[model samples]
Target: MHSLPPLAALKAFFVACHAGSYTAAARELYITHGAVSRHIQVVEKWFGVNLFIKQGQRRVPTPYALTLARELGGAFDTLSDIALRYGNGGRNNVFNVSVPTTLSLKWLLPRLDDFYARFPDANLQISTANTEQLHIIGHYDLLIRRETSGTEYSAIPFLQDHHCLMASPALLKRHAIERPIDIFSCPRIETLTRPGQWNLWLKAAGLDKSAGNGIRRYDHFHVSLHAMLEGIGVGLGPINTLSQEISRGNLQPLFAKITVAPNQYYALTPVGVQKTLLHRAFEDWLVSQGQRDIKLADLPL
Candidate 1:
């Protein structure tokens, strides 16, 4: 323990490397920028290495420093998780979750009231982001997103996401979309987040990719779904997530048999961390909700 560098300096260096700037690190640590720099200098001196180099009015981490940062990140996350687990005598009911944007809006939000009704004592902090950050394990207790690669974490499949062409009743009436070829005449809406979606659907339907007139691009599925509901165009929609809209007759699925199963939604938890009772409760509830929604959606499977 006597040979160990100062814990504060190591923590500061770890944070500064990730934050990209000493000022940002200072803000996060509630310390002055100079304090952060001094802490980093202490770490550099203890380690006998140059961790950062100035480049065009900004400091960039050296390759060796980035390697150290990765190691420190995992160590810190493990320490934090351990602290969180026993810090309150295992009474921490505050669960943090990260979810993709469109899914949060279309599916999760609608079902949250029921969750609160069941677990009134549960404190849920939900964040919606398009990208998963490296610090997700440290910041969030769970992540709900499309299937991700890698076996580093435990990913439990919850919901099935199969996309099909859909449009409002009014748009369907005007387009005369009886045959697959008739769909080319109507406006096509594309979700920018799900690239190559239109092509995938077209290929599945045995139609040429260039069949549609033109496409209006939206960043997320919820936005494109809204455009479809307004009769702006016909777009691909996930059946299970859009169960409410489909059941209410706001949007009608076209050629339901031509749907494509791209991927499924998953609830991921960091490996090695002990799951609290709250974690198990929420995950079980989510799985149950997904099963019920799939049946309600009446998907062709």
Candidate 2:
């Protein structure tokens, strides 16, 4: 017979690795902190080694523990995917989709009602993560990500994205940006996730990349967009996603002729996977909506 630690202990340890602390894991697992500690202790004893050790005020997983956690994460994810795909729930129109965080917040989430109205029976389980996280996350019927050079999945074009300089009306007024060069006088807001965006926009506008007065970096595009809306700085705004904000005069797109960094969002699925009716319906709907958006915005294909 195979010897194994208690299932509860393994679960506690797994959650603790990702949660970053025992207390956080306890909170997530709905167990007392002492109970979580006890569970982890059981796993440690079963393995004949310490999985976590105190480092300053935090408990850090050992290297061996980190490796174990990675394997366990994949195993648990596979199990979850299998259950979701083959269980009775799978017979329904339930579909799991992973999307980028900012795109989901600013774009897809707003348009989901339309999808629901069109197909009342379709149930979408949406998860948001960055492009990097999508690689580590579990199985999904579909994923929305920017078109990258070497993606392994089959990609279908979902949306068009073009970047242009944009800032709040008040901020633009304060900065007196009469020309592309004048933007350097304003603080340049950037996202840590897409550090090359500012450079790409600047280069497309025929300006030096290093000419900005100051750089402020946020961890995500949504945060940077919010900062720009607050008149903290100027940022590269995604034309299609922020169209409403521009139309309402909340923000102003500058340099009408200098739009750059044309990228497309793609609906991706693992290569060679069977496509179900749910997948076909959602994909068709997404493409139709994306096309309609471009047509209504009077943007080029």
TM-score of 2: 0.72
Worst 10 residues of 1 by lDDT: 292-301
Each model's C-alpha lDDT?
Answer: 0.82, 0.82
| lDDT of candidate 1 over 1-301, digit per residue (tens) | 3797788999999988998988889999999999999999998998899999998887778999999999988888778865775577767666878887778887898899999999998888788876644345456778887755577568889898778888899898888888777778988998887798788888988899965577788887667888999998888988888877888889888788787755688898877656788899999998998988754235532
lDDT of 2 by residue, 163-224 (tens): 88888988977889888898888798989987788777788778887765688889878889
Model 2, which residues run further than 4 Å from truth? Answer: 1-74, 132-134, 148-151, 208-212, 294-301
- Candidate with top TM-score is 2
How many steric clashes between backbone atoms does each model show? 0, 0
Query: Given candidate 2, what's the lDDT at residue 106?
Result: 75
